[model samples]
Target chain A: MSQKQIAGVTIDVNDEGYMTNHAQWNRDVAAALAKEEGIDLTEGHWKVLDFIDKDFKEKSAVPGMRRMNKVGGIETKELYSLFPNGPIKKATKIAGYPKPVSCV
Target chain B: MPDDDEIKKVSIIVSRGSLEGVYPGLIMANGARMKGIDANLFFTFFGLHAIVKKKMNNIKIGTVGNPALCVPTPMGVGMPTWLGAIPGMSWIATAMMKKEMEKIDIPPVGEFVEMIHDAGGKIYACKATVDMFKLAPQDFCPQVDKVLTVGEFYEMSAGAQIIFT
Candidate 1:
């Protein structure tokens, strides 16, 4: 498979700027995750999703929870609250990013 | 090009009881599975409680000197880990952690374990630690795959990156 295919999600950019094939699905998943954790998705949520996607793309590994916490400047407690199901999995899924290989 | 056979393995060793300590293992293990890598979690010592008897998601916070618990000041004030052992502190700390987790979208321990299982990651209980702590299999979360000795765990973690969180 080519790099694009291996990456799983398709990226498309138009007049509206970059949009991913799984954008709608990601939003839906993020909304569900947010509901489960009883938090609203603010700008902070997008920031984290962006970070996870970028990091995973570059490193080919999911950012460890601590790295995410430190880079996001989010406390572990607060980060857990946002990702109650765990950030790397739930958040990546919601962000339409591939799941990291190290997760399970 | 990255060779198909060159896939890296990641193994995590969990040994603490605080939400901070426990969640990292769970999240990393699950993330590894998601990425199609070989991943495993070996729960030992106090970390065993995270996967034990439905108590994984119920981990209390270490309110003592946990840097994460501090409020923002001109500098900043954080909870010290030392306070985690104070009498009656675990209860309050756990409550705070639960509340914090609820505020975010993370699931409780039970559900998180379910998620890990669903993602195809392996979970093991440390046999020696279990015996040392007098814990039975029934004391562990139902999702555990087996009770393994440290030797067995090391064997599984061998040839992989071992992370102690």
Candidate 2:
């Protein structure tokens, strides 16, 4: 774990720059992280991030493509469009969650 | 594509039909796509069963001669080779494997194909195998993008790492 200053706040992050402590996550932090990934958070993007954050609290784990597609009402292709590369990795990082395991 | 140190593409040849044989290639191709790498799954021979419309959902484990069926037993002992020949062993083994995979959120073969395709990975069927088996285009699952000849397969694999599984 390491510390990083994002949006003028010291936040704990992992080697991959994923926020380790979810408590430090806020809109400012999320926007800062998204900016670093060259993403501008839109309403669609927040829908995914909110679903992930809420689902993480409920399941205590990161959600994968299947869950997002089936339950989160997000299509797989839409996820790719939103996050570009690997949606799970980028979404988890911006949402203050851990890297998702390749579950599905 | 950006000129970088990262591997940009991979062409995975899945040549076996057995559950164990097929998952490695599927997982690897999926992993590659998760890394933003271009991945292509070329199914040849019995591996075509993974892309066959009917057979894809019913992939079986070979219980009779599989020496490495190391799945858990009810008694926590290794599977005996002789026990594999028993009637219904393959079915039992398939059920156990499916249960275990489901527990970890791993999808069945058909859904796995859809997932990879949805994530922008390509799926292909070998033309020689399809012709040898007298299969047609409609026999393959919908996610398969093409049935490619050897020349076409080679052409598609250019500049991509070829891994035969």
Candidate 3:
């Protein structure tokens, strides 16, 4: 366990930097996390994040990338461009959701 | 810092045709593409069966002599190898696996390949295997981009992370 402070707020995070407490999330935290990943939060990024958050609450796991593109209403290429290191990993982590158990 | 944002690519080699052996490459390649990374898959040896039009979707699960078979269930208990070796068990096991994948919204083989292709992942056949098997272009599913020699595969995969499954 570790603590990370961003935008003057403290949150608990796992060693991998994923927030351990989902309830601590706010838009400011998302923006700060995205900035750390070298991303500038945009409407497109928010769209995917919003989908991830909503899906996590409803389905208990963020939809895989194909579903995110097809059902979550974002194009595959656009998702990559938004969270370039690894789209699903980066976006869900920033969205304040637990990392997917099956994703590598 | 600039290097952190550089787009990455991966090249995967699929060398077996068993349902267990084949799907990892498909899933990983698809995952990479969904993340916006370029992915190339090279199917060789028995792995060609994964792309073979008539056989791709019909590949069976390996039950006999397989030590790693785990029947995922609520109890978390695994199927013993002896049980797996029983007559007709492979078919039953395959059906169970397919049903489980469907529960998680994972697509079948043919549809999985199409989704990967639609996401811009490139699938290829190994030239040697295609020649050894005397397979023609039409023998493969439409999603396979081309058949390539080992040298060509290495050339295309230059600087990309390469994985064998």
Superposing all C-alpha atoms, what RMSD in Å does each candidate have to the true structure? Answer: 11.8, 2.2, 4.3
* Count of backbone clashes, every candidate in sequence: 39, 0, 0
**In model 1, which runs have C-alpha deviations exceeding 4 angstroms?**
A1-104, B4-7, B72-76, B79-89
Per-model TM-score, in order, reads: 0.57, 0.93, 0.75
**For model 3 chain B, the run of ten residues with the poorest summed lDDT:** B70-79
User: Could you give candidate 1's per-residue lDDT for residues B101-147 as a string of tens digits?
Assistant: 65454557776776666556678888888899888767877779999
Q: Write the per-residue lDDT of candidate 3 for residues B1-165, one digit (tens) a residue.
A: 496676589999999999988999999998787566889999999999988999999988889887767767524666677997788888988998899787676778887887777667898999999999999989999989999999999999998999999
Please identify model 3 stretches exceeding 4 Å from their true place: A66-75, B1-10, B28-39, B63-90, B115-121, B159-163
| Highest-scoring model, lDDT | 2
Per-prediction DockQ comes to 0.12, 0.62, 0.23
Q: How accurate is candidate 1 locally (lDDT)?
A: 0.66
Give me the displacement of residue A73 in model 2, in angstroms. Answer: 2.5
Cα lDDT of model 2 by residue, B1-165, tens digit = 367767989999999998888998998888787778899999999999999998998888889876776647644566778899999988889999889887776789998888899889999999999989999888888899999998999999999999999
RMSD of 1: 11.8
Which candidate ranks first by DockQ, i.e. highest?
A: 2
Model 1 B-chain TM: 0.80
